[model samples]
Target: MTDEPQRAGRRTRLYALTDGRTAAPHTVLTMDTTITAAVDAHDGLPSEWRAVLAMCPAPNGRAVAEIAARMRMRLTPMALLLGELADRGLIHHRPPLEGAETTNVHLLMRIRDNLARI
Candidate 1:
């Protein structure tokens, strides 16, 4: 069997390629005498996703399937939601794993982990 630490390193790298989306941005409505927010704003993301998103330590990006699994749905549904967000300028959909920033974050996480073990 491979070393546990090395296997963990590979697992970390695998997950690195999955992150690509950003967190949903919250728009600030005017703080007037009366402020009305959507049910979602007060309620937060659908229960399923709220927990899953919370579990994401890095708090950015997701593989299509990752979101779907959280919602207990299929990839098609997640794709639709992501598309809708992008269309509404609420979120951006990245091309697969093209973002350099995600890679940097992933690398940083790996370094942090390795350092912690030393």
Candidate 2:
């Protein structure tokens, strides 16, 4: 049987996961972080990493947030997976233009309070 149904189901799940409101969008996946496939071809990647690698645009690469959105995965877990792939030399992950920043609890709390007000 074709894997079409399985692929479609996966896409559906990704959509559902990404549709909900999240507290720290910036923390998970941000526009500036770029992701590129390090290998020439999909040879020995884990299935999940394969899916992530597939989502990355060739040559130009893709933003981390875009991948997370397409994959319908939470940014935190996605970040971990990406990190693993990068460590394996299967993918390249570039920090955002401004460089990575440590999480500031005060800032997050402020954003959360503001969002709650809306």
Candidate 3:
């Protein structure tokens, strides 16, 4: 997201902490790893990213591009993060509409190009 691999690495670590655990059955902590991770992710989220996610998975569960502008976030990184969230199953990714994927890519590229100028 920041033109560096380390941010992505850190994001992966953050996702591991915040996702994939259920409190059902109320079992004891099998590992302290999860707790630590959650704390880490919660503390590390970029203010912008955190703010974006706070308003995400929109009321209608719209596509990433649709939400990006509203959040004033760059499209490429937001797309990457959406993929990450979906991969983690923290959020659901609806299969694109018949041609939504194509249109989505076009929009993202356009946004990326436009932002590059600034």
Candidate with more favorable, higher TM-score: 1 or 2: 2
Question: How does each model score on TM-score?
Answer: 0.36, 0.53, 0.37
Question: Can you rank all candidates by TM-score, best first?
Answer: 2, 3, 1
Decoy 3 TM-score against native: 0.37
Tens-digit per-residue lDDT, 5-31, candidate 3: 122322333335335332222222111
The true-versus-predicted C-alpha distance at residue 95 of model 2, in Å, is 2.5
Instruction: Quote the positional error of residue 60 for candidate 2 in Å.
Output: 1.2
Global lDDT of each model? Answer: 0.37, 0.56, 0.41
Model 2 has an lDDT value of 0.56
Residue 86 local lDDT, model 3: 44
What TM-score does model 1 achieve against the real structure?
Answer: 0.36
| Global lDDT of model 1 | 0.37
Q: Which segments of candidate 1 are over 4 A away from where they belong?
A: 1-59, 98-118
Q: Write the per-residue lDDT of candidate 1 for residues 1-85, one digit (tens) a residue.
A: 2111111222222112224433323332111111111122113344332333332323244445545544455565455444434
Alpha-carbon shift of residue 76 in model 1 (angstroms): 1.0
1 or 3: which has the higher lDDT? 3
